[model samples]
Target: MPDDKTALVISAHSADFVWRGGGAIALHRAMGYAVTVVCLSYGERGESAKLWKQDGMTLEKVKTARRTEAENAAAELGVTDIRFFDVGDYPLDLGPDTRDRMVDVIREVQPRWMMTHSKWDPYNTDHMNTMRFTLDCRMVAQAWGHNPGQKVLGAPQLYLFEPHQTEQMGWTPDVFLDITEVWDRKWAAIQCMQGQEHLWSYYRNVAENRANHLRRNSGGQAGGRAAKYAEGFQTVFPRTVDALE
Candidate 1:
């Protein structure tokens, strides 16, 4: 574990951080990385069965509940800095304005690595927009493009997390992290969703399936992969991870 590693996870919605990359977040925290999560929205419109079912569930109530859920979930992963950006919920607009906001955040954080969805996804408009924002943010940082009013930031290494539906979306992961050691933490973190039981089960199964693939593909890392889970990621551009001593 690195003593002073900083990680930033930028998610389209609150649950994406938990359901998709929970293990990675948890493992990073456990390994002593300072994990910061940027949740674009509270997921009020697209999904909120649990809170909606409650009597007299207002928008404020849903926002509060989701915020608490995110806090608890991220806490499980030892993450302490949570930026709950009050962006739109589901079916988010990835217009130029949103791109500007993303660029500003990138400039402020100046993170070494940024993870978002692959630009190839089709079903989820929000996912596609997220990729656009990430790419645009990079271009703005590198001064390859203009993001008026946003300070310039250095280009960061970029990564694309695996899409939940790999086949339908045609996601191909070139890198997979053996998160076997952190699977339980991932599961526990996801339980905070509290809004969807069936959805949680589906994600859990996905994690298991990814683990199976890891065992077969880990090669030398295969020794510790049995009965473990993993996460896959796709990269858009070449990355240079500086070796720090």
Candidate 2:
């Protein structure tokens, strides 16, 4: 509903977007871009360790808590829309229906840019599987023959946000977004992920480390910008431009 200026984030789990790209979401939203996040699953089975440790936590209870957390996080991040597929995680899959649904969302949003998981994640196959499904669904959305009446999607830049373990995940950052101004918002969103309390400080540290990288690469030690918080991303496709910035 925000014209052609929209961004889509295809996350494997409810909290994946928060940990990996909350700053990017908040930053873009502040720049007048409508950010929409899609969570493939609640991450109940694998990622909700805190909730599971409770005295008696049912499957539905875990799902509800995860959903509420995600919604609260999205609001804090200034997200325009947050969709939950609720397909379940652990070993995330993209069945025919799910694939079609993703394609539909792509067409509907007609995003100018998109973000998703890395191509590989040894620690969590669900993260890798999400990348596969995102690419597959994007292809379907681009094909005019798939759905005659629907509009075909344009080639949008897909950026892979930082994973928990970038070393093993083989993710290299080509862009570092200075999110100091919106750091508080990102922190608030991070707090909404109560199920992963242990990661709160971990991700905050990641942001600070990325800010250091931003400062160094931006101007070196002598003239480096003073960015206190930042988010890193790896571009999945080559960026084309007529002139260098």
Candidate 3:
């Protein structure tokens, strides 16, 4: 681990982090890790239907609403730092300065591990594009020759959180995290996303379902640990261990 135990999460939209990795953020924060979340965009254009449906809704107003919700959610999850790029969505393009800024964050945090969306998403190009840009920035941050004086990053495993529709997104989870203790915190964070009210109970159901999987995979024998709520993740890089349990 670095001098400071840190972890980074890159989200395509303002609320993506909460819906996808809120449990992980809370669980890790409770474990003495500083979790930093970077929201690439507010998702105002594409994902803010509820806000847009209201009368006399402007872009700035929607953005403000989205930012407020994310900030509250981040607090609920005990996030150490939360940054917003304020980049427009619905084809979320990385502005010229955005990539360098992201590199700066990666260098600053020096996270031991990172999290983001899956490699592909049929329904949302923004999700996949964000993943691509995150990986690209990570590669740049890891190269000592690129920035010279700036701190270069070490090898950090990137965990892809569950997509909205995992079956259609080709996401297969290999890691199941038991977030039973922090489930309440995650639920509070999920509630912060009032813009996406429809997904509240949906994600709760997902946690319950993943807990079942966690229970079965944790050697479903007599007296196995019971996980009441869990979150699943897919590791992008193969982990190296000295010995098997």
* TM-score, cand. 3 vs. native: 0.97
Each prediction's TM-score against the native?
0.85, 0.98, 0.97
RMSD of each: 3.8, 1.0, 1.3
Candidate 2, lDDT over the whole model: 0.93
Q: What is candidate 3's lDDT per residue for 153-235, written digit by digit as tens?
A: 98899999999988999899999999999999999999999999999999999999999999999878755569999999999
lDDT string for model 1 (118-231, tens) is: 666676777768777777767876673565565566656677887767787777887777777887778888888897666888887887877777777755364745656788
Q: Where does candidate 1 stray beyond 4 Å? A: 1-4, 144-152, 220-227, 239-245
Q: What's model 1's overall lDDT?
A: 0.75
Between candidates 1 and 2, the one scoring higher on TM-score is 2
Clashes of each: 0, 0, 0
RMSD of 2: 1.0
Displacement of the residue 40 alpha carbon in candidate 3, Å: 0.4
User: For model 3, what is the error of residue 212's alpha carbon versus the real structure, in angstroms, after optimal superposition?
Assistant: 0.3
- Worst ten-residue run, lDDT, model 1? 1-10
